[model samples]
Target: MTKHRVRTVERYTRRTRWYHAAVYITVLALLGTGWWLLTGREGEPSPAARLTGAADVTLHTYAGWVLTGLTAVAITLGARAARTFVVESVRVDKGDLRWFIRWPVAVVTGRFSHHRGHFDPGQRVANLVLVTLLAALVASGVGLTMVVGGPGFVWLQRVHRWATYLITPVLAGHILIAAGLLPGYRGVARAMHLGGRLRVDTARRVWPGWLDRRLAEDDKQPARAEGDSPD
Candidate 1:
């Protein structure tokens, strides 16, 4: 096998890596308990509830709070940096449009590609939806837990349930992509776990436009300095 030249590129900041871990872990906790809570109740214990016992409800409730706290902390700590990430990931352009149309088809057909993106358009859009769902879940969960029976508190519970229904599948997809189960994606988890360094070749494939732009800037720096130097 021919060896390709490799480089280490900074992919995620320390805070970003930790925050991502916290969010996913908390979300997973919330989902697990939430599923059991949804299926099983005091009088009518579903299989999940039967297996887990009374602890599931308690766990579910606390998990929601934990999720809320983690999300808030992430925002507080990373808002400034997050703005850059959001801009890079969420912005739609011609490349994103092209990638989305072909990429979705490719994924479904089992002919996948590591197409260009700062963040893949599909992932960016899906993340936006998930974020919106998370906000709804947090708000409704707080209303249900804190109010606990005030006017429309049942409605709050309803909203939270609905939001979670949407969140569950989307989260599953996100995990598949991160786990590298999705075709053409060999998981992006390494950056979050292993010092946030991305393999330059992989980064180039997935984020070619961003890589190119950065490379262009790098190239210009020497030229700029040379022009500035006294002849």
Candidate 2:
């Protein structure tokens, strides 16, 4: 029997994967504790609170702070990548509407329509919604911490709660897809986890345009290096 080599592509950088992990972990922490407090468990000590020796509110506040700090750092240090992410997320491709039309059936059939961008049409919508919701949550949370009792406080509280309510389902759907629960998205999680790579076939299927561009870039490297060599 002959051994065969499997080809793979790096879909995400290590820094990108680490940033994603940090953001999700912090967001989950905030959501868990915030919901616990909102659901009348304010004074009650859950297992996590007991383990950490902190109240639900304290944990939630600290998690929010961590998330805020992470966002600040990303915006400042990863400005270029952040700009690219926003631009890609908001860009409308010619066939985006058609892509969305096909996506529902394609989820089960594993026959996604070809799209031209870093994100699929569904992901573009998700990115915009998720970022907006997260920004609202962060802003409202910070305002809540500052304002004690007033109309401003009440307004911030409402924003925070509504943002949470909205983000929970959106985040859940994102998780379901990213977890590879959908047939067409199977093996997709490898792009953000497990060394941030995916089989070439998987990459090609899920991100044909991106994969083609990446391959083209790869093909130019050796020729460029050879041209730069001393004669």
Candidate 3:
């Protein structure tokens, strides 16, 4: 079985890839450390409690800062691309709706629909929610620094907690997809490469509209150059 038939394309830049990996690591670390902090009730210190230690708050705080910093860096690195993605994500048509309808089946059967958008309809919706929730999470986290022991602090804590709870599952799904654990999305995980490439076929199927537009743009460049040449 020769797998060399798949052509490769640059789907993500190295810096973008790093941003993604850092975001994943930072969020998971924050979640793990923050979980016990959020859920544990008063009790005598157990081994697990001892494991968490007093610095847990500090760890979570710094992790939150790292998350914010990375988010900033990502935007700085790819402001144009990021803006394009956000703008394109607002578009939805019958194709996207069909993709969403078959999404669950794809998850179970490993046979994905040929989605033709910057993001599938489900992904666009999820992306919007996550962006909104993450912004709330960061805002509340920063606000916690400002109000330590007042009603404001209580409200901010709830905001932070609720946002964390909401994004946890989305984050889990993201991790699963990146790790190629999802059924139809197996090889699709390679798109998050740190200066790595993507299989052309996977790119075409998963991001057909994007791939097509990009290729069309590439084609135009050569023609434009020729047209500009002096005889």
Candidate 4:
């Protein structure tokens, strides 16, 4: 007799995927444009830098508009769900505290292991802070870019400049956190590299309640003898 294995179906909604991809790509473009604007070389800019810089900065401006549009769409389509994610991610619970303590202990002893479920309370808190910071950064950046043409307050300009500097460390810490979860997180990176699809396990782990239910269902079917029929 052959034994059947259960497979889980886990994935992001197409709209959610679109939202994440657009935000990240535009973020990279914004970073590139910001780098050039801050640290352009003396004399005429190199053709490569000139073209890339112009294209990216333009894209970044429009991308901010796109992000605003997407945010509206998300609120419309899944207002409740989005709000729940926002709330849960921001709530610093006892679990997060425990996780924090365990993480360092595990790291020191070379036994770093974590629960295999959805984002922990700590991760949710970090994600919420990151998203809020990113939104503020984008808003300030848009205003700063329009300074030449629009109303630009000196203090606002300085705030935008300092925001970029501060956000760099936050972004670095985010990357380091992901790296620490590489065993589970590598596929999130791969999903982009492969254009959305990833190993099923990765998706299940990333979105446990949403996708892992299928696996649970798979496990509950009763085994039958070779010739037995359903009653």
**Candidate lDDT values, in order:** 0.69, 0.87, 0.72, 0.56
TM-score ranking, high to low: 2, 3, 1, 4
Q: Rank the candidates by lDDT, best first.
A: 2, 3, 1, 4
> Looking at model 4, which ten-residue stretch has the lowest summed lDDT?
222-231
Q: Model 1, which residues run further than 4 Å from truth?
A: 1-5, 41-54, 105-117, 214-231
Q: Which prediction has more favorable TM-score, 2 or 4?
A: 2
TM-score of predicted model 1? 0.78
Better by lDDT, candidate 4 or 3: 3
TM-score of 2: 0.94
lDDT of candidate 2 over 45-128, digit per residue (tens): 977799999888889999999999999987999999999999999999898888889999999987889998998889989999
The candidate, 1 or 2, that scores higher on TM-score is 2
lDDT of 3 by residue, 37-139 (tens): 7877334343444776846677778889998887786588768877977876677776676787788887757655766676767778878887888889889
Q: Weakest 10 consecutive residues, lDDT, candidate 2?
A: 222-231
Clashes of 3: 0
RMSD of 4: 6.9
Among all candidates shown, the one with the greatest TM-score: 2
Q: Which lDDT value does model 4 have at 109?
A: 48
lDDT of 4: 0.56
Each prediction's RMSD over C-alphas, in Å, is 7.4, 5.0, 6.7, 6.9
